[model samples]
Target: MFMRKSKFRHVFGQGLKRDQCYDNIRITKSSWDSRYCDVNPKYVAVITEAAGGGSFLVLPLSKVGRVERDCPLVAGHKAAVLDIAWCPHNDDVIASASEDCTIKIWQIPEGGLTKPLTEPVVDLVAHQRRVSCVKWHPTAHNVLLSAGSDNKIYIWNVGTGEVFTEIDLPDLPLSASFNFNGSKFACTCKDKKLRVYNSRSGECLQEGPGHAGAKPAQVAYLKDGLIFSTGFSRMSERQYALWDEKDLSKAKEMNELDNSNGVIFPLYDADVNMVYLCGKGDSQIRYFEVTDEEPYVHYLNTYQSKESGRGVGFMPKRGLNVNNCEIARIYKLHNSGLCEVIPFTVPRKSELFQDDLYPDTPSDTPALSAEEWFGGKDADPIMVSLKGGFVPTRKDALKVVRRSNVLDKMPTRTSQAQSTNSEAAAAPSLPPKPSTTSTPPDEHVGFDPQGILDDMRKLKLIVKAHERRIKTLEEKLSQYEVNTSEEDEGKA
Candidate 1:
């Protein structure tokens, strides 16, 4: 009987439901450091610190079964690799720039050491100082750009593995970027200037002011040929500025940002014309959208993790098929002293990209069909019904009523005139006699004297209240004037 009772309980009892994938598998800081993952047609190559302290490792973004099949694609830099670039046109090609003052280009499947790219195809050692930035050409597939502490920018061609053109800058270059079409490129340097160049001719097309203090950490291009720059001020303020491509002599400063913890990781999302300022003492990512006026920025949300660090790479537009896709992979240097990746999906989708008919939450769940939303065999409409019905009925209704009252209560000539007369004498204005401007009625207009009288009474009360306020203000002003005169005479 005890066994039978247990069996019945097991068969009929209900408990907690299984956790959804979105909630259960949060991208936590792992042992691996994936600072930047660039996706190609066939593979995703991530740039990470191999054992910390200047060493770098590259891994392909593929899995054999459940575990990732990672092979060190490149090695041999004496110092920490500052940055890496992939050949925009070739899937198996990549390049790395390091603090060792060298830039190496490698083919993925090249032979030599046991691991692929345990060797490099060609090495370019031209920079006198540490290389900080590397980027591929917008249109020229094999061409790349590298900037370093030497305050120089080198344009290189991978085919020849040589410097194609060398350009000099005013200060130590921090970040650089290419425009959408490849016609122009821009760079931010320690000198506090953003310079735009003509990629084909290597000519300085334009340059703009970015406050000079600590050089800009990042620069990016926005739509309509606009640009953004982020850096720190001498006063310990974090600064962000926007510029127009045509005339770079001046820029519109977004706002004087208070540095949260003296560290700012600024990133620009061109797909949505948004620039994100991340990091500091707080673990929140702040977002700013570009506009003709001043750029508007707001804190998106905060991540609660001491393991989380400042290194985050936003997935470019080509990566995912959704709007305001903010699941930017973030990392921090921790634990065994390795980088960890945290994937964050924005809680709400931008209103700009939402459907005109109805906006919804950002859900990883596969969207249900119309039949499912209405009534389907597998779906329980009650769940959706309850979720959708969560809208605050009472508060929303009051808001609508308040807005309607604003337009409904605007002072009209008839109401204003009725308000001037005493309540007993003032009568509601008679409906205007049929005028030529009036639409001809099927029959003569019928007047409602009682309705008119009630409206006139209400109008008189409102106007009288306004008149009382005006009279009070005038009396105060007269008293102020009398006091001023007396004070002046006493002084004389």
Candidate 2:
């Protein structure tokens, strides 16, 4: 028998025990094709069903147990929440888009939600139709892109509450993604075409035929100017393909995965060059190794389970268990109101850190600001070492500084033939002002001194907790070294 000699060939999936999972959650019943859940190192947020408006539950990763019926929620939108994404540079920050034709940015507290969060840090109301998707820039601070049913995409600077760029599409976008450095953008549209564009300039770069099916399609930008997409064929058979950005007239490699009707969600790990495909309402996760060779995508193995998942949230690499050789962790949401934690680990007997399985992954640091990115600048993500285990740095609360209303001061248009050039020139020069229009008189204005003091107190407590955990880990590592030395001496 011949076997592949790869470090991840023996990878296995393990589901946590029932007590370790979150139960009694009222997941949303929206028909929207979204993950419905998002996770980070600090918290895991799940879109839940609400009566009057849209709401989602944000729980600390340590609070794994049966949730109460009246748990606190982040409720604000007037409609169902379609998508949610956590900021890559700040674990405490998250963005949510909804059918209310707006997007909201929230900042979760350190100890988790004690009361219902009705107010968002920033309220963006630009889309005329319901917003479908929201994504944060990979390496930029406070930069966000949102897609709406109006056949439009707007890139916003959350810190400033301003639209940095507006891109109009011919059809609705099924999915959108940014390249590794956040310089290029790609999306699959309802017109059955995959379109690539300059993210900043909103210029269409290329367009080609996407999947042949009528169902929704997804696109993910990979390393080295590559793109991966998943959709159905004309016969409704599930299929996947890899494409080169330079030439999208045809896919570099294409293959049919299966005949399942569930939508396949692709999650890519750039460090290991592996992509995991998880189908909605399916009990299996198929993974593949991507390369630059002839067959670009090579199928590995599949992780099968008895229970199917309605949505899945992937944990960042920095949150994995390095001591246990764990490479990936996914939080799968079930129809039975249960959220299960599944860990994928590579088989290894050694107790030491495995550098090959874990490379220098992206850190929680912004490589560019919103102004710089909108000014046509691009930079790679900042990488951090995980040798001694990753310790998250404390970050201050995000501040939103909006410009004054220039529309109120502009002269009224006398005729329809008035040049629009004057209006565009006046927008940028408006003096900056604290956005207190949305807040009540009693509420704290832009930089709240009391809020800062509270945040500092919470950060101090968090630092103390991390220090204690690190000390315990150090002691265990020392004991393991001593035991290994004794065993070696006895063998000699």
Candidate 3:
């Protein structure tokens, strides 16, 4: 286990791996998914969806050194696979959730997925709706959580084909996850609420409203039982909030200034207490270090994705005190269906910079009381916008290019006869310093058909949102109609 000592960790280089899959006979739009399966702290597994519809691919963090292409894993899913997770107890096994409304479990070979999956050992079908998210229990090998359109969270025991419990939430559940200790889990639903539940008892222990008037897309647990959620705000701003699980009345802190234009992807790095936040606003990944004390957010840095539209995952860091904070890497589903594994060497020490670079003074922590924290006329939240959209941390960006060999892969410019090209004519000038409403990495490249499939993903999100709203509104409407009918009968 790598020892984690302090905050001033150095940035490391990322490894590159790619596979241009063209085996499927039926050609349709290309789609991509990404996940980091840590079979061990030293070996992180990365899985990707091949272009069009075929089989899923897997790559190990160790094999990155040999420059071998990613190979397909167990390929039983007849449709595009959506989510993949590694079992906690047995590292060799993995579970996949697909659009086919089924969750398939497979045992990975020691040599890796270089060979075909003759068959999936287990196929569970408990979800009545599309299984959008699938996660393994932190401690239990066969325990899993799958949430989807059914407005419910299902706790399934992979050892048997039975669901241990079902959480029939009032709204559509968006994202769910188990904490490191496995004592509790947190989930976000379409009602803009963050609910923490006991995994064993299957009971809601605590619940809090998040992203007022807007459905929350993702929620994550931080150190000291603090939870973070990202979703839309009533004003359309991408809202990110930090809440204390024990006290759900109000968020310890709330940041609603993300201008990702509705792109709602989020991932948390529990090791360094960092949040790897990415989505519609920029083509890069932004890092925010979570502190243990008040005002728990420290803007760390950002890294641009090599391929246009890719999903991202932070490799699980067991206990490494390396210079670079990141232990493993995964891409966000982006324009290019290409996925790469980034292998980095941690540095000794490093400093952080940000737009609202708060001085490392005592006043950094909020002096406000709990009453002030909630249930009052709150102070205006601080809005910090990095001048050029997602500002890339130079070291991190260079590391990505160096390890990924991105520059070498770019089309070479063969300038043969142009001799008198003016200095002004050359290097056309950077696009008008993008305004505050800067296009997110995903949106910037969203136009590239190869980068993002049909924007069908956006449609799915919107449809889900509408479905939740209708569900809520109809329930209220039915109650009101009943009350009015009762009054009419009394008058008669």
Off by over 4 Å in 3: 1-6, 9-54, 62-73, 213-216, 262-264, 305-307, 318-334, 343-346, 349-492
What overall lDDT, based on C-alpha atoms, would model 3 receive against the true structure? 0.53
- Winner on lDDT (1 vs 2): 2
lDDT of 3 by residue, 261-310 (tens): 64556677554466767664256665666887556776655666555433
lDDT of 1 by residue, 445-474 (tens): 576554564455446545643575588699
- When summed lDDT is taken over every stretch of 10 residues in candidate 2, the lowest stretch is 407-416
* lDDT against true structure, model 2: 0.82
Off by over 4 Å in 1: 1-54, 62-73, 109-116, 261-263, 280-282, 293-305, 321-492
How would you encode candidate 2's per-residue C-alpha lDDT over 1-492 as one tens digit per residue?
A: 955456777788888998998999999999888999999988999999999899999999999999999999999899999999998888877899999988988878778999999866656666779999998899877789999998989888675455778899999988999999998889999988998988888999989898999999998899999999999999999999999998889999999988988888898888888888988999988888888876889887889888998998989898889999999988888999999888999989999999999999998877776656777889999898788899875444232222322211111231112223343322322233335797457554486653564344335434543575588699999999999999999999
Q: What is the C-alpha lDDT of each candidate?
A: 0.50, 0.82, 0.53
State every prediction's TM-score relative to the real structure: 0.55, 0.81, 0.60
Candidate topping lDDT: 2
How many clashing pairs in candidate 1?
2
> Lowest lDDT 10-mer window, candidate 1?
6-15
| Ordered list by TM-score, greatest first | 2, 3, 1
Clashes (backbone N, CA, C under 3 Å), per candidate, total 2, 0, 31
